[model samples]
Target: MKTLSKMHGPARERGVVLLFCLIILVVLLAGGVAVMRSMDTSLAGAGNLAFKRDLVNQGELAIAKAMREFNASGALAATGATSNNVAAANYSAVQLATNAQGIPEVLLKKTDLNGPDVLGNTFRPTGTPISGSGGSTVRYVIDRMCNATGTFASIGKSGCVYTPSKTETPGGDQSQLATPGPSVPSPPIYRVSVRVDGPRDTQVFLQASFTKPE
Candidate 1:
């Protein structure tokens, strides 16, 4: 029988296991770093969304204040008040000029808080903020949806957007039939824009248009 002999033609591979282990370690480290970065981005996005939602909820306060001002018995609806612009009350009888964003130019003019806008039109005074706390402030402006000032009759139907006070509609009795009522002139639609400034330079703008009967 031929004698079996150990033939070592080349040096046995050394540190092969060590090299394999090092490569695996590097791959795992890279995966871990990628996962950590993804987590951070998700956390930041969630935080920003939460802040925005909270700020929007706070805008209800401004809406309530505007409703009060337009109350039939309130100062704004009093004799001669509705027909004229009241700067102190932050109200305008005519619609104000707006920017490309549809945001009132007056609200964008911060250099002079109460100065005129880019069109040289007087800024409707925002007056004092309706409410503020914890680095948040809420303010609003009201404008009648009309091209000209004065009573709705004087502005003519083409100059303003309005609806009659009493329109034929279904009553609250759950009946589908229409209920008839005499049509009477109602106040023109008024737009209220609320601005909320919050922490981290976050700002929210909201608008609501409504009509109040005289």
Candidate 2:
């Protein structure tokens, strides 16, 4: 019998084993890469959700602030010297002017906290009486008062409404008389509405109604 050469026999077998080990390493590397990619995608989605939740919270706070201002302005009162409930009109007009003028002052009027008449950017509905808070990324309208009463109660009518157009939706209609005994009368109630654009073409709406404070 012929003796087999040790180098040709065992050495060749060792080379084959080395090749198999290399292939296994390559496969593990590919699997690791896939896992890493999946993790990255999950992280991105979580980040986006967190950002959106933050925006919603900011919007809700903005509405509350606007309600406080509306109460303070005496604009929501039934008997006040300058109680026009024209917050929506005034703010809309100002915003229109700013959009047309492209002046920093105009934008600042609605955005600046120290501006003369800090609540100048509020939106007041005529019949509904909506108010708003400024200085937020998204604009909102909150109505704290309404002029409706009697059998045709206007409790549900009081709330917020989003107005992207130059012209906003008018608030609830007031009753001509008080105490709808023979005829329907309107009493003053309150409403709050909020509108926000998370991004271009993305809009959200929120509305609520409250009884007028005694």
Candidate 3:
């Protein structure tokens, strides 16, 4: 009877050992699956960030185009040219309405000003979308920092943000000059807003402000 009992005891112990091995295997499998899922999520996040950075870098192209348009010999170079809204040039002499975030309402996809007078007239890259290396499209709008659209004299310096540079023979003060000092009209500040559209329906907005000689 003792010998028979010993044989049964060893057999039961073997079965218990096999059950423990299976439990350990199951635990390891679950841990491996969890790790793989975590890795995949991390990879996806990194890819999204990289794509956004690429889109932002591509915004420089729009900014460069706007600068050229505002420089001398460009369509917006003359003082009279900036006195009114030029839909073709995407230029506005008066300040544009902006959203709560300070983004121009004209550049928004859906806004009250989405008519031909505003959103429908934004300037694209030469009337077409300029494709970037990452398949992004760029557009921009320029607005002069003024309350109304008209001649500088009509709007007056108080109505616009103008920076005056003294050109009165260096040391000569305008108050002391015998005659009205040479009219040194400082440049007016212009704001350029750029929008970049990229893959996955991602959109990026960039803005820059500069002064150009009138």
User: Number of the top candidate by TM-score?
Assistant: 1
lDDT of 2 at 74: 39
What TM-score against the true fold does each predicted structure earn?
0.79, 0.43, 0.72
Clashing pairs in 3: none
Q: What value of lDDT does candidate 3 attain over all alpha carbons? A: 0.74
Report the alpha-carbon TM-score of model 2 versus the true structure: 0.43
Compared with the true structure, what per-residue lDDT tens digits does model 2 show for residues 1-214?
9998765434334478789999999999999999999999999899878756766675675456555554645344334312333443222211211223332122232333111122344333322222323333555543333232221132232322222122222342235324333322233334444545454344444545444323
Question: Residue 159 in candidate 3 has what lDDT?
Answer: 83
- State which candidate, 1 or 2, has the greater TM-score: 1
Q: Candidate 2 — which residues are off by over 4 angstroms?
A: 1-19, 69-72, 79-136, 143-191, 198-208
What is the per-residue lDDT of model 3 for residues 1-214, given as tens digits with 9 covering 90 to 100?
A: 4565443433334478789999999999999999999999999999988888888889888888778876787788776888887766777777777787878877776222232223334332223445787677787788888877787777777788776666554444567656765677667788988778887678999999998765
Per-residue lDDT over 120-197 for candidate 1, one digit per residue giving the tens place of the 0 to 100 score: 557557467755666788877888877776787777756777764445242323244366455456567988987888
What do the candidate models score in CA lDDT, each in turn?
0.74, 0.42, 0.74
**Candidate 1 runs further than 4 Å off:** 1-11, 14-16, 114-120, 164-183
Alpha-carbon shift of residue 34 in model 1 (angstroms): 1.8
Clashes of each: 0, 24, 0
